[model samples]
Target: MAGPMISHSPAAPPRPGPGRRVVLGRRVVLGAALGWGAAGLAGCGAGREPVQRLRLATGPEGGPYNAFGRALAAATQGHAPAVVPLATAASVDNLHRLDDGSVELALAMADTAEDAVRGRNSFGRPLPVAALARIYVNYTHLLAPADGPVRTVADLAGRRVAVGADGSGVQVVARRLLETASLTGGAGRVAEVPLALGESVAALCAGRVDALFWSGGVPTPAVAELARELPLRVLALDGPAGVLRARYGPVYTAAEFPAGVYGLREPVGTVGVGNYLLARTDVPADAVCAVLRTVFDAWRDLLREVTAGARLEPRFAVSTGAVPLHPGATAYYRSVYG
Candidate 1:
């Protein structure tokens, strides 16, 4: 999978080729499209009932989650249960809100979702959250100045690193990667700083931090803009990918950033994690089904706003791994496959 690198050209997004499953590196896209109309969607346990107002927990401002959330909210302008995007710290924070009934929906990294459901890592207890869909893959980006002293993961030892904002999936993975490189736990520990995507960019440009970690869809707008302002390279984490997967599970996939992204002459290896659309168990099944219809039906319009939006596929959408599917989502998928 490609890391977040903004595209400047008007190149068309990739579509499924001939086969039933089109393999692109570690990800797959279904050739069959879910082009069902309103009548078909109504049969998926909801019978055309309008959905209620729902608040979706999205990431911090200028992040992929927030951008996609706002786009989705706009798509539901005429639909019921108007989806309001709630700007948050992403992943862990979103999950907490879902558990506490602060929000009805969320976008979270699969790794973080797994942790919350299992009551491990960032969560203090098991959360009553379930998957609506495995939305897209998020590439882990370890960014550093192109002409800086740090060239590899090992070089990050004893240096300051912006490990994303508090209660974010970026921080969870960043700290673990540091631990894997033996850059934490002792004298060689990295000086960790928590900052949102925009803040991290500014800090890096001002030399306040040596590196920053971000996990988002390919060509994240903020990251792309940062690249144009300052020359930086995404550090490779191929070796650590295996370690993380071995320790945490298959949530972490070994992937790479393609050449020409961020103007790189070569691909940079990194870890990839699936991003899931989630909802609390208390969310009504009909409402969840309606939201799924909105997401899958309006994907092309969403594509114009976020690249991850273009990745909405039937087969790929159902792969939530350990996170169990919401009943409404189950009904929606059954209708599609049937």
Candidate 2:
């Protein structure tokens, strides 16, 4: 069952465009890998005239959010009215944008969305957010200069680092990783520079920053290409995990970066977290249902971005712990399971 090739950002890789062997998450793709039986969205909206337009918030040009968002927009062309993929800071920024009514639906890391919903950490206060789906796992990438003084997280201390822009999932994860490594700046030695996802790589390459922490799918095009141009190394997060999980919820999972990814000399041990599709709690149930129905109905279309998971089952869709599932999504899941 092949289909049209989706044109994603120019910054990402050129091969295996969407429906290849690219794998993501604890299980895999929510579309075919999960073997979801699509019954169409006809039951989602019922008699409604259909939504007119929708705004989707994704990460910068070279990240997963942007790639998935475009594929999503294409899938929603007729079903969701109109979906517009807008590039933002990713996760934290996307939630804030959704909170402020700038975008109707946004993609975010589960941990960041939990913080926004509970008004903790980088999130200023409690926000009204609901989860539509738990998509894939974003492995934390702690990239450093190959020729620099960094081998482990300890070396990040006293270095100029790019920890994503304000209101971004990268900021949330970077701060937590630093805390996990017990490297929250000794005497304010670590200079944290916040930059947009589109800017982080360039800054590190130009000698503007020592390293940049990123959370995304494997072989993230920008970082993969950057490794070829610059001597880069990934730092392993082999530190205490229980404390961070207890403090930040169960979003973080133990994961490994394969040895060959980004041309690393050896496999880097890191953490993995779930990325989610989030929406406002105020959105109509049927409208939300319609959107998700289209997602699953057209799940195959998202194959390029939401790589097929290996062992995950569609029944695990509602497993997101903190963020409550959107009624529409729940309804669709109910229909799928029941």
Candidate 3:
């Protein structure tokens, strides 16, 4: 029988008039070749052509996804397959790439991944993607000028808040959080401002925005910079810290932003969601399994090399909710944990 076919559609063009053209330039072809290489081990049957590369969709430069991708590439290189990292917009974009076959592997937020698989949130239809591993949890940090009046998540009502670029995971979760806190749809409570991560800090400093919500790893450069130069406070969500986990499923958990993690005077309680590695349903099982093995075997070393705070223990790598685990990755987890 022939293997499953994966489709690569053009990404929705940058916002403006009609969506931007989905450019299938040389990079797309290169990405496809890399993806094949990463999954090559599964095609080793007699008379099959050898696979050459694997393409991974990472996030914007300097973000946790990008760093993790680079580390993953380094760990997988020459062991199972040659891996290439394609920097993308972030979680939502990464999931779209995985669904459209633009890349074989991607990094996604558990919440966003849940929405895509269930067609519940931003994704209008169910997406055909599966999880390889749950890597780490992203703490939603609501950063405001330390002296600002916005002391809680609800205080941002009616104020200009940078929710990250449109279609980005930041925007998706920010809206959900606002609604959860009852800050949306009311007069003078919530104003969503779509801005890139790079521009969000400047916008806040210039007083164009009152607060900025970012979900990322510890010591993010943007967050650290803002904390150092400005009077910044990381706000605490209103409900109990574990409320999201209880209502939304185990994908979220209560996490602490330690006091002095970024020069804060005290620890701040918040909700967090995991980040997972994802792939299209059509990816070969053997290839996926090989990649999973490589990542797991090198988890500690990769964590040390990428970000000091990142923890890749096997205990934190299993998907808990709407996100479906890939068969190959499931095998890997069973082999290691069982």
The most accurate candidate by TM-score is: 1
The ten-residue window of minimal lDDT in model 2 covers 1-10
Candidate 3 C-alpha error for residue 263, in Å: 1.6
After superposing candidate 3 on the true structure, give the runs of residues whose Cα lies further than 4 Å from its correct spot. Answer: 1-50, 238-243, 304-307
Off by over 4 Å in 1: 1-43, 47-50, 308-310
lDDT of 1 by residue, 104-219 (tens): 99999999999998998788888999888877778889999999998999899899999999999999999889989998878888999999889999999999999999988667
- Candidate 2, superposed: residue stretches over 4 Å from native: 1-47, 303-313
Lowest summed lDDT over 10 consecutive residues: which window, candidate 3? 1-10
Tens-place lDDT digits, model 3, residues 244-316: 6666776666667778866788877776667788888777666776787778677766555333456554444
Clashes of 2: 9
Ranked candidates (TM-score, high to low): 1, 2, 3
Better of 2 and 3 by TM-score: 2
User: 1 or 3, which is superior by lDDT?
Assistant: 1
Model 3 RMSD to the real structure? 13.4
